[model samples]
Target: MGNTMLYVITSLSVGGAQKALLNLASSDFSRDYPPVVIALVEVDGVQKQFAEAGIPVHVLGINRLTQLPWVLPRLFGLVRKIKPQVIHGWMHHGNLFATLTWWLAGCRPVLLWGMHHTPEKATLERKQHALVLKVGRWLSRFPQQIVYVSRRSMQRHAELGYAMQHAQVIANGIPLGNNREQAAHYASVRQELGIPANARLIGSLTRYVPEKDIPNLLNAIRLYQEGGEDAHFLLAGEGMNAHNPALQPLLSALPDAIKVHLLGVRTDAQRLIAALDIATLSSQREAFPLFLAEAMAAGVPCVATDVGDIAEFVADTGTIVPVADAAALANALSGLLNQAPKVRESLGEQARQRVAARYSLNAVIQAYQQMLGKVATYSVSNA
Candidate 1:
């Protein structure tokens, strides 16, 4: 059997889809598959992680739509040379590009499409994505399967005429480890961020995008602080730094009592999450947020909006509030902070157990192996 798989992705940026592909490529499952990565754009944050895992990465240096034609030949050339038995595409652009490239290369390798985001109506980016999905629907028959990270996303896409022959919902999983290891770093992380040792820490790890509703989170923090809660808010991710002009208004609106630590794009996200007393997600839309799972894996209880699989992820372990409701978010956060230390600790333990039992990396890899094995058999039988 040919033990080769090629994964095509938009970029190696530090986002959910990129992280998911990185996890899949670096897992023990790769021992059988011997994965290769190809990014449509120049590799950035996660390229080193892949390289260290002995995976070769190819970048096509595509930054805009005009470069598609110039890069197609390059993609076709690589596909022919590698002749992988399975070509997996991550996200919409990667899926479309992989299908077209495979067709152009005249190959019959099993093609798999991975979808990571939920459909939302308002954003212009989503509108563009809808157009892409329309085209992908026409090409759906070319891929052996379309994998969605959330059941809601799959159903919503199906309703939008994405009638693929084979579709599966595989929730994103986190690699679990000893929570104590991270817990030990809590005091130091707090000290480095200049957060008082006695202050309650509520942290959020997400990019500063409209969908993330960061201002709504800020408003909630304001409400919480107005009520005289002794808490510090930590916001970390892309575009979350002090120099980001967009954050100025929101930061100014926050009460003086609330100390806001804006750590932009920290590579030490896991340590920051470990130091958090409660993790949060204020996104108005999500498919299956990897951060929520990561927080749960770290045994930190989460408080998230009831958006995309969040309620399911938190289920009895953490609090879930309605979307864009600052007051409701504030109330939830305050209630959790007011809980006795032992009660919060118990909830965190429950969160950890839930992630270990349901969303462990081992389980996710096994499911992918089964699916790939079946797809491989089918491809061979057809040939």
Candidate 2:
């Protein structure tokens, strides 16, 4: 554990930040750093993935803000015991907690912060995040470096008074090889979803949150269906099912001919992507969504809103539309769906190439390794 790097995140949930951390932890880069993960709250989801990868994960059992006082001492004790060379924080609450723990433990490790979101639109889920940004402006000197998953997120945080001098941008990366096995399951996945073999499958992998704008996607699907397109939709993520009262009305309003399968929190997302003719994202806010990258890696063309870095990621490989514009989304989907098989395949190839060249997991892992090496040297010199 000489070069141990402790990763502190708000939780070990199956979101973008947690997924990125898992990628980093499971990669060859972790061999040099020997990464350990610490969740501020109790480890719920995706923690097993890290453990299975031979990474040690610890939970502080701090479920809410009220538990901070009791949990801080536990964090301090862990810091003193582990004596990690670096303390890397993910997201707002985790960053603040890491900074506090570093100060309290009197540790000499280099501190780094990671930001995975864009604060373009304020929502109740992000109210605490807004407060953290305000407080981070004053405590910006704590972290040796702050890594933003997208350039847009870096710019937004800089504008919001975060430390610009120490900021860096590192986009999320996906393992291209991870989808290779999924090709074998494509037909089976479609059959499992009750979709016809020839039906145009438009899929979205996202949590059913207000920011995701899943209703807008449903509206677009309705419009496309009204035009007599034979399509099926596969939406797989948390809160995507009809069990939610708010989404039941929207789900009920969809046209009868369009087959919609709501598979909540699926483990076979890559296989679902493999079975799709097109992937879609209707998010109002994001900072380089992982699903879009994953879809492209799976050689699936995407139709997404012009939010965050989605347009930049898709480039000419796919289509982009304005947020909340169901008509534009429908038109884009219709155009892609109407394309010849050869044409669509060509576009999908371009998407896969783009991801391979820019967002490969190996490249991202090397980037983090380089950063960690520098931070380690800096900390040793200062010590």
Candidate 3:
């Protein structure tokens, strides 16, 4: 009914966590022991990526609290029939759901939980979500190993009383084998957007959310223009559109001199990233931003706020500024904008080299393989 390894994630979307899991699913490590992907909900477009990769995909389609009872029985039945050897959870909700299914199935498969996001205070704002974390922290001990994509996430969870005895840090591995698109590739996007070839193309692949701080980036774009430089910005991701309240007021205030193109939830992220002169993020929080690593891997110079693992990850290859400091972001963007083409190319090459050295996909797969021994001492039933 399903593959040996079961991967449970909150939802199927075109996000970093999903991409990382997809990469793992497509790897040689998975060829020997394939995984059945389970998403609580399905978003359009990305489910096709999983199907194309030859993995079995199952969506519970649980959109609301009322749907939980109806959907969970199907999940439970699937678990009972498949008898997955390993249950790997992605994010908090997924981990809890995996644990639930593991219990109901009466199968003691190896349980591995993945922690991908920062433990910001804002997360505990919801009573229900707050309850989930409390339950997760208490139930955290049952998993064979808890994998944190960033050390900060791991340390933060440990502080929150997660079982640190079996916890380990494994950064999201970037597939470094992708061929960098040539200038012609970016020229196509620039042509479609009506942005001039000479205009500095600064782009960010992020949603219009409080954490992403798109408003801050808009302010920086304004200040950069006020200082006598003209540039075009391409923003893409879920909710990164004209209708988003978090973005509208800021977007309305920016001068006409600065061009901002909102491409909502693009599948061709690599092509878009490659076409840019600079890649940026003014996010308030992050563990390790795979987009920055991907941009760097493509030899694109980056300007990001110093958050989470960014300062350490970018090192000397890219510029890191203080969060919420529009002027500082403006100055950094301007610094890169003013650089000669050759100098920028050299900097971009250096950025690519940094990512190649540390964040390769193979290294991550090996780390996962080491931790993923045979189904723990558990495996009460394979039937």
Supply candidate 3's per-residue lDDT for 75. Answer: 90
Candidate 3's TM-score? 0.94
lDDT of 3: 0.84
**TM-score of every model versus the real structure:** 0.96, 0.95, 0.94
Better structure of 1 and 3 per TM-score:
1
Candidate 1: which pairs clash?
none
Question: lDDT per residue, candidate 3, 135-175, as tens digits?
Answer: 99999988888899888788778777888988888888887
Quote the RMSD, in angstroms, for model 2: 1.8
- Provide the clashing-pair count of each candidate structure: 0, 0, 0
Model 1 ranges with Cα > 4 A deviation: 123-127
* Candidate 1 structure quality by residue, lDDT tens digits, 52-145: 8788999998998898889888888898888887888898888988787668656577789998977767632566777887887788778898
Candidates' C-alpha lDDT: 0.85, 0.84, 0.84
lDDT of 2: 0.84
Position 63, candidate 3: lDDT: 73
